[model samples]
Target: MSGNTARRPLRADALRNYERILAAAQGAFAAHGASASLEEIARQAGVGSATLHRHFPSRRSLLEVVFHDRVEALCAKAQERAEENEPGAALFSWLGDLNAYAAASRGLVASLLHDGRDTDLLQQNDSCKTMITTAADELLRRARQAGAVRPGVHTEDLLTLVSAISLATEHPDDEQAGRLLDIAIHGIRLHQHQRAATNRETPARFSE
Candidate 1:
């Protein structure tokens, strides 16, 4: 779900070139949106247009790699949170990370949707979505088990809420994003005594 599993082995120099292209593309896309020029990207990477083309083939391919790398990093963070003892804190912290990633990639979301769409881009997006869903579902389940989160709060609900916050504050600061997440997390979190009572009442559902 993280690494380039299907990609063939590249020569050391080729790999360096590839990494340069990706790094350059990331900066260009961040500044110029999804429709940024291929020539400019190639120039920034210090590679000829033919070289960039040979590696990425198309604009969507390059965009997919950049977005995929972000998703991979986010997934890694989620995995790290899963290992932590604090379920509620881990979930909330990971949600904060998601908010940050969304904020940073403001330009890329446009390419994942209508008009500028490509099959490869859509598939890559779907893969990233699946990885995120799986990670969030595990964290949410753990929180619910610990009674730190309310029952019936599925992965989709948490994602939708955070995604909305991210989109709403696309041009705003991290404080705004954090405040909104705090509000959402507060609504879902259960208190200690409440958790105990809920566990008793819904033993078959929550407690093992």
Candidate 2:
């Protein structure tokens, strides 16, 4: 809102076009899949295919922006949550919010996550890599110290597990993921020693 920033001359129309393209692309990818037609995106945005291609040269380009936007938002939330609350509580709350976000955007950003699907996240941005891991590490440290989560719990593995739970619940048995997450959290708690040797639980994949 400052005069200097506001007065800076730029292509107002192109800005509108990019916004339009992104809006259309978001809808297209959610309703469709990664292979959704670019032409449809342009048509929906009320722009020519050339304009869409100008802003996003390929499907990967479009996907990268969408994925990066969600990840950056998540990172900001992680930082806010960490500062606003104690470590364990912050981590727990962030886990819930992130679970909801992954559930919501799983259709759009699932491929962009670490599970060897979206190479674009690797190439286009490092936003998700930094904050998410840092948040996880901090939470893990606090949880371990408080005896909430067990020691030697891999942060990457935990992230993957949550992400997979969100990803897998795209269909039936959606109710189980939250319950399973709670159970896993309970089992991983330091005070909860599972004396059952027959427990063959495997952690979910948190590759991204």
Candidate 3:
């Protein structure tokens, strides 16, 4: 999932070609999303189609490699933020960062989320999803323990909300994504005054 872990090691020249192909694919996916032209990626990598195919047998395979390290890096950032910032601030900041990443990456994350028949690819996607969920769970747990988050808030709900925002934004931009994330974070955090106000504003139910 994270690279060529299941295969034999590449020879030096093959490794060079593999790296070039991966770089090219990354750029192309970033620029053009999941449906970027494979031929164009091969051309950009200065490799023949046969060589490109030799390195990556499928588009899904190429995409997995291109975004795997990026997801890992985001998880790593979560760890750093947890260590460096207060629980509430770290959770909100990491969500903002994740929103920005999802927006900027265009459709790559969606591609990974797409349900496919490939058994191996499905497993890899599940792994990525698990990694993200685990990272979020830890942050959310910290925030709850610190009384920064409301009780009963699940990591799955937060992730789903973020994914929805990223998908709804017309253009992939940090400003828009950050704004939406801020709104969501405000909604997620515990606000005793707000809750009290809402309780007071509710009319008494008719006795029945």
Candidate 4:
């Protein structure tokens, strides 16, 4: 038998390594916040630290990649939800999922948000932020039209829900997020009730 050995493709291994690194980094960031070490990332990924450096070069670079990937995913999800027939349901579903997505990003989001506007990834067109907002707005509008969600529900409030969830999910319990979301949704729906009570507390005054 001729002992001819075919060279295994580095591309396949490289791709696999990249995927593993991302998975490990994501878990590490969520578990330990943004300051988690690259060594630990490599350990979780089963790759040497040298391999991590080879792919990411620097911590900031890896962070930017993670943030960019998360934003793109959110945009895609928004688009998919918008295409659904029920806009309000799509909006709520996407809003809930987006919080999950952002929560998953953990430290990555904080880094990206703190970046200056001049940063490439933070530029207006670079991040899919506008597109996602637009998609979300359309969904909210349709839901309002259908009388499914509260009227005069601005997109910003739905946005606040995602941000709230992101901040609230720091605790480990997975159900904490859903509870936070429910609280937000309930507040939005009962906003008028709150305002009415506030008005009632104020004395009726007439200038004669």
lDDT value, residue 141 of candidate 3: 91
| TM-score leader | 1
- Give the alpha-carbon lDDT of every model: 0.81, 0.68, 0.78, 0.68
Q: Per-residue lDDT tens digits of candidate 2, residues 61-164?
A: 67777666666667678788878987666777777777766666666554445345665455545645666788778877776566465445778877887877
Model 3, 1-208: lDDT tens digits are: 2443477877989888988898788888777767789999999999999999997899877877777766777888999999999999999999987886677576654444454333365465676777789999999999977868765678988999998898889465567777888898989987888556544563345111
Candidate 2 similarity to native, TM-score:
0.62
lDDT of 4 by residue, 142-165 (tens): 776665665456887788768767
Each prediction's TM-score versus the true structure: 0.81, 0.62, 0.70, 0.67
Candidate of highest lDDT: 1
Q: Is candidate 3 or candidate 4 better by lDDT?
A: 3
RMSD in order of candidates: 3.3, 8.1, 6.0, 10.0
Worst ten in a row by lDDT for model 2: 1-10
In model 2, which regions exceed 4 Å deviation?
1-17, 42-51, 104-127, 145-148, 167-170, 173-175, 189-208
